[model samples]
Target: METTSKGTEDKGISRARFLAGAAALGLAGAVLPATGAQAADARAGRAGRPGRGLTRRGVVYTVGAGETPGTAWDPARMRADVRSIRHDLHANTVDVTGDGVERLTATAAEAAERDLHVWLQPTLGDVPQRDILEHLAECGRFADRLRGQGASVELSVGCEFWLFVPGIVPGETVLERIENLQNGTADPEQVQRRLTAFTAKAAAVGRSVFGGRLGYAAAQDDEVDWSLFDVVGIDYYSYHEHPADYVRELRRYLRWGKPLAITEFGTCTYAGAPQAGGMGWSVVDYDKDPPEIKGNLVRSERTQAAYLTDLLSVFESMGLYGAMAFEFLSADAPHRPDDPLHDLDMASYALTKPIRDRPDDPASPWHWEPKDAFHALSRRYARTC
Candidate 1:
């Protein structure tokens, strides 16, 4: 997920957690060589032979998709969620992401164990290139191990590093860097050059450890050199940036002749969220005591449902490799009926609405009711090839 105005990236990971994650993955400071059998499939990174290029029908499941969710270690809860994504959503692949290597590896391993093609994505925000590279190295090694277990896996090296990596843009922080990019204060060519340099280094790092296909999830304006990546993934929001034809907009990446995937795409649950694009969550006054919706916004599951189904159809028509819905659950954002001000789920892109406790069902502590969007996606994906 991109570091938005909400400061999800600032959740700061502990050194112990990172090291524990490294040890969990058997990362003993040595990059292993790929097996001779591993080279059977080339660009698509499939098993034994080259298969259909873009077969990942999926959803992007962040360990904690929202900033508040990821660090909570709950395998039973997470595994159940993964099962739902595979069985309920009918998705063949899952683009698993989050900052902590331990959580990233744990969540991705769960997906892989469920026989879902795991897209292991490591993300760290507002860090130096060195820190990002280190995160990538850890992920690459773990992904390589996962593939070695005979699972279909890919290591998407890093994400929007130009925005996350410091010193590339003039902004001291990610928000400042983004501001420079938006205001046209940052040099386009300079940004591209530096980004390219960092990506090249990242690709080299990936190849050194991971035998599987590698990629990066680019932001809307990123000028990625696709030659270094096997799959072209974008954090594509349907009406974001007011693009005339999203299919036409997506075709720009097809020029590279690489398989494409929508790394992340989903709108909030408000009335006009379909058009708000990435800023849909801005309606909430996060600084408030209880975090209330700023305006008198009407929550519409129908709007969310229709938007998702329509976009899935659009992506299918375009013959995409895959388009991962932004998320499966937003645990921290619970649904509060008749309370729009505190109904944080209105701003969440999750297919399932989370609830703190179900009054009637004491047997199940935390229960999530599938919204119309969830079933809409399931019906669409169930019918998909």
Candidate 2:
């Protein structure tokens, strides 16, 4: 992996210069009008909506690692790490999983020492409806843990359930399962009713816990039940064909009067190779395979960097609230040696090569190294903050 110094100053581009540059790049007509001055101001840290800011105050935490410190809760070490990350990255928000509440609370206290925000990406197992009430009840019980630690928490009940449901189950079976899970029966009509009921219940539960502010992460556009969330969260791996498209999508969501966050956004370096561990949901591979292929899609470091730059640019222009890269490190295990075709096959592709050490090692090919994209994003965040 190649390391590059992050430039401290903005590569000053005036409106006219920006237009000229866009025209030269054949994007002037396509992006200028839709992304007007308001958006531009948002990016520039000038005029912003109530909670919108260009500061890159975001970090994505893994289930048992990354932000969590030590085998157990070593308060001193956790505080040091949290302070280091916040000071170094200018991060204001750190995402924590539900099961990791104890560690999350510990980290939140550390964050409080540094004055940062915390968002909880609560993990509900495959069967959310099985104990939806119980799941929510636990969240209520945990709310005090968050408040006690001097951290405000946004409860993310489910992540990417859309992929697990309709993406995997047949339509008829999908309806049946939804019905069974929601209402204790397998009737299609009941399925729709249950979904509606669940949305209301979830929203009510969230409002009671977070004072009417709730967040949810969705992997696909279709998975979003907008009525259930105050803020819409999305995880995009390959949706960004270009930077302009990213801007357009953000604008679409911004119109809803709700803030938008790119909860998880990163490119897989492997292209089309099967994800090493079959751990994530992906649409393509990086090895120049046809879109229909089921594997990791490999893109060069330069391409990845450019994509990230464009993404950040769009986020700035659209007045987006914030974004978190998919991860800070690589997976702990190699592609599951026993099942190469599993969902996580593309897991290793998310990290930069240097972090991984040996990108070619299949057994433990997954490692965390900062690639050009990481630096680019870090620099961008540093500047904006």
Candidate 3:
């Protein structure tokens, strides 16, 4: 379960929708926690490797500029958003994920200009595998160009291929495929084999074009052959259903001796979200014309804020290479304080709430208000290092 927060509405796939089913099964009975000596070694290993983890704090930003009406992607607005990420959230790194090669690389350039480390992730869906491969080639070329200019840039080829890549999973779209996984129709063993094969080829393609760091954002279900990557990227979100010792679970990734990074980790804005983890976004009802959260999910920015600091503590204890908050902003999920049903931001994992456009006041400039999670990250990151 790769707890995705891609928010790739621009790609014709609702990121939360596709990922909801993946996190449904939960880790309660699936994976047991390491105890006794195993737990002690996990802690000992972390302590022995001093100064090896979480040297940088970061956040994820999706840029689907001009791809959709609801997506907030004005170049001027994005520049300001990047400024917020650096100055407000105090993040030293930024993971840029989305479809367009130009937009993805352009956002990386923005982060580079600000002296922030950049992770360039090209997330494409519902497209041919060849097209995806081509997209990766272009992204690598651009990332290498950034590196040539002395920018700290790494290329994450893609994420959670079991759902995004067409044939790896059972269904036609990402959502359907995930539902299949949840329904026990998809073979986990078959998915793993295909995932490894696809990742090896993707890593090779990335290395061929890019000279900097290369990796993939793996899901919890993926058994990645880490030898192909320069870094181990995992999207970590604690499952509230059955809490496992995160330190114990993460220790396995350390075996490779590569820098381990949490490429995505964050909860939604509503109550009980901290427990739901990645599936917190499942509350949204997309069938509506404008789309909004389902039923009565009470909004609680405090819940989101607490989830942030708690996970940061765990990441620090484990000493990760970096921990990027699932996202900085969700353009597709706008804030509607007056309308709870229509407050799409409630299900969003973004730190900031993008205000939906007002037909009555079209003259008002594009704007978004930072949620409490944003402040929590700022305080924690500012104190860090």
Candidate 4:
């Protein structure tokens, strides 16, 4: 999710202007009215035509992740989140990503209870080949367990292996790998060869134990051999310079003859965040003890909503398998009510505002409020084609 000198930065679209455009397009008012019958009618309209308009409407529910504080493991909260996705967002799938096996299995099981397909992605960050295989086997074990429970699950072998895992590329840190690639120090041919070899091995090991769909979150620019898996997955993010090519670039996946999954895509909660994919994570200065905005940035929830709606349209129009929003929430980047201007949560790609102080019993479910994107996504996903 981090990049070097790709020259792709936020284009700084005016929030007010984008919202004005959305209002004119009727997207702002497209949210389903708060009534169960109306929602059911809207959903029934699409029942006849399946696999249209992101049939696998999905969001990545990240837990126990590295950069963001792990969502506290609560089965009740997990059930609520899954139900919310199925009922409110009209999503049929959940990309349950995390590191630990226990949390990953529990999340997948809960999503299964809600009848949502699960993309089980476990992060084994910056480890060697042996460790990677070990993690893959662990995922396979959990996938089998979930299957025994009759849960639908797909095992993502790993994410961005060339960048994060060792032996595949020559860099001590993720940033270092990016620097090497930019400086012509990392051989492209050698890197691709190592990646292909390692990925093939991962798929082989994963398939041995995991009896379900398999794929890797290949970086958009990476030349991955897709024959090893059932799904062609890409962590696609729009760039400022290549706005028009977004759909055109994704069409190449059709050549793989596998289900195309946009494994990750989403915008931050700012005016220009739609185009902030490549460099969004790097924009903030994290050197300080507590990260804050690097400069004055305008908060525009509509920009994110617009970006998501447009991308969903492209995915649906193309008749691709499915896509997952980068994330449902960023628990660590909680809202800053006191310093609203410095609320880094606004920069989060998540569709909800993470609240830190839970004003109730310690056992109360975690509280999070939705953004405009959440409602917009619900409306868009509810449509048929």
Candidate 5:
């Protein structure tokens, strides 16, 4: 039982006009509508023309996490950060976390004040199947709040279900849990049906708020019922078999005739680390006490930069919508000094140093500063907008 909004029916040709305008401007691969009615109004602002001012280059933004008062959503900090990013990287969008919806709204308001776009990444935490329907209903209410404020959200990153399942539970156990979870609450025969209905309902909320521009973030191979989303959202962490391979995979998604967004992508760049295969595949921690016998891969700053350059080049050449870096700032989590694997923790993946106090020793991985990959991305994005 999904419903379409009135604005969607009247905006059919508007979407086409925007895509055509992007294609005409040499941005031929993917076309993403900027968020909110302001973008639409911006289109209308161009001399009362019905179909102009659309661009192929999709909006670019940084990801912000954590609940830190000033670091996460301070208006002054957001303005300064957005101003710096625009100056140094041409990124115009800020993807704020869902739990911080009020803070995000405030940040978005600041962004709007500064003439920047704000994309809210809503999080649907792990829920028992019995609560699925209720959760979705609550999501609808949240979307209504955004709409009432005259704000539009870009993507509603639904449940990170994969992380909960295979990451924690074993193989067959995971499948059984899914079945039990669904059956315990709803009709067993309608599990898939309910899931699809729920996904569509959530997406509809986004479309209602954002005038039909919406997407979801998912694992690379996660099988999402396509009826729920308008674009392909995939996360690629270690898929850099080669530069052409990246292009090939992205092109594969384009064959679906929908825009693609690389919601998460990055490499560890450390040697002797085990990489996780696709979704549902077991993870192989290279630093395990009894290391699993697998292919050894070496990651370095130079390699990271090369991989990024190739991917970005392919994205730009194909005129795909746009891509966001995995993160903006380093995680504030502290690293454990006694453990070898501590160097590979979440904090290590940051492009910048942590604000928290740590050992000043040079031998610590925390001692590593921004590598060439950071500057490479900064340079490319800075020049693009």
Candidate 6:
């Protein structure tokens, strides 16, 4: 669920394919508003409070780069997207992901306008492990700026370190690491050790520059040193390996005795997608010229809606701090109902499909159509838990 726009195509496509397969805020006791200035005021009230109630009912707002240039980061598009998430999707928070400081800043400002609390993550695509701190330091600078403006933001130093950042894992590239993983050649313990060591350093630097909450987005199976963070964040995708024990799996995190948040969760728009879960998108052939499904495929928006509703129910039952759906939109995977080969949206996990052409009407500001998950989440978020 954590991705960067500027990532290499091979790396990007590997992720897109893997993702075709698979897929926070703290406030202890404050009630949240559905929207408007009141929501902003409510979040402002819990900016740094420890005992505040769950405030991160969120959806990730993303714009990717590389082959899918349609989804590349744009300030104007970000503004419109943030607004839709606030007024239309009914999310009170957003986890904004982008490559550089400027993009993250633009995203943060727009989220603030919509009264959304944020988890700001830098997309550290191919940065060497030695220099990762520099990127995170930029994030700290942005965090300081936003905090000055009274925005509720958490600085995530990095995500899925083993795959994204070099040196921590066996390979210099993500695809290499992924191959190592698939072949069972990569050692999980070794990856965890390096990640822990690097995160300790990142936490120290992040704490010095930004005075608010700080956390790292760890993969579900990777154990992190929770002492390094104020909040325990995990990018969990429910492949539903053990439905009956799902809550039990999450409960183990409470041993950290910190606020736990599901940093990412959701599936693609296709029949049996919920069953495919995190691995749904990975089913596509990345080697194909334009990336197509390996065999027969069926598109079903409802499958995605079901995935969101089911996961949200589990999150609410777990009584965890908060959760964000994997994403609000994917700009690159434009919808093409006219041509099956060009209909790349079947591989996308976004809540809405990007429109190939904008309508001539000024009234029609949106460039995408809401899928079933959008309505499902909007209705769910409209209610108070």
**Best prediction by lDDT:** 3
Candidate 5 ranges with C-alpha deviation above 4 Å: 1-80, 127-153, 157-194, 272-299, 333-348, 358-371
lDDT of each: 0.71, 0.46, 0.75, 0.67, 0.42, 0.69
RMSD of each candidate relative to the true structure = 10.3, 13.3, 4.2, 11.9, 13.8, 9.9
Clash counts for the predictions, in order: 1, 36, 1, 0, 2, 21
Error of 5 at 132 (Å): 8.1
Span of 10 residues, lowest total lDDT, candidate 2: 1-10
> Which residue runs of candidate 4 sit more than 4 Å off their true CA positions?
1-51, 65-76, 240-244, 358-366
Instruction: In candidate 4, list every pair of residues with a backbone clash.
Output: none
In terms of lDDT, the poorest run of 10 residues in model 3 is 26-35
Predicted candidate 5 versus true structure: per-residue lDDT over 1-385, tens digit per residue: 0000101112221111222222233331111212354234333421111222212222223323432322233455556655654455455554543333444456555555554454555443333433433443454455455556665445543543432212222222323333334335324334334445556666665565554356766555444555567766665554555655555555545544566666555543343221321210111233453222123333355655665566667666666655655444433222333433333322223344333334433223322244566677777765656
Candidate 1 per-residue lDDT, tens place, 192-261, comes to 6787898899889988999989888887656667889898878876574333376556666676678788
Candidate 2 vs candidate 4, TM-score winner: 4
Candidates ranked, most accurate by TM-score first: 3, 6, 1, 4, 2, 5
What TM-score, computed on C-alpha atoms, does each candidate reach? 0.81, 0.60, 0.87, 0.80, 0.59, 0.83
Higher-scoring candidate on TM-score, 4 or 5: 4
Q: 1 or 3: which has the higher lDDT?
A: 3
lDDT of 4 by residue, 343-371 (tens): 76676778788665642222333478888
Candidate 6 C-alpha lDDT tens digits along 350-374: 8898766642222223378899999
lDDT of 2 at 349: 36
Clashing pairs in 5: 89-382, 269-299
What is the Å distance of residue 324 in model 1 from its true position? Answer: 0.3
| Candidate 3, pairs of clashing residues | 54-320
Expressed as tens digits, the lDDT of each residue in 1-385 for candidate 3 is 3343343555655565554434453322122123364455445543214444477699988876432553546677778889988888888999998878777877899999999999999987667778888998998999999999999998999987766788787777766765676668877767767777888888989999999889889865356778999888988777543224666667766876898888988989988887776567767666566565777789999988988878787778767788899888776667888888888789888899878468223243446898999998999888863
- For residue 334, model 2's alpha carbon misses the true position, in angstroms, by 5.7
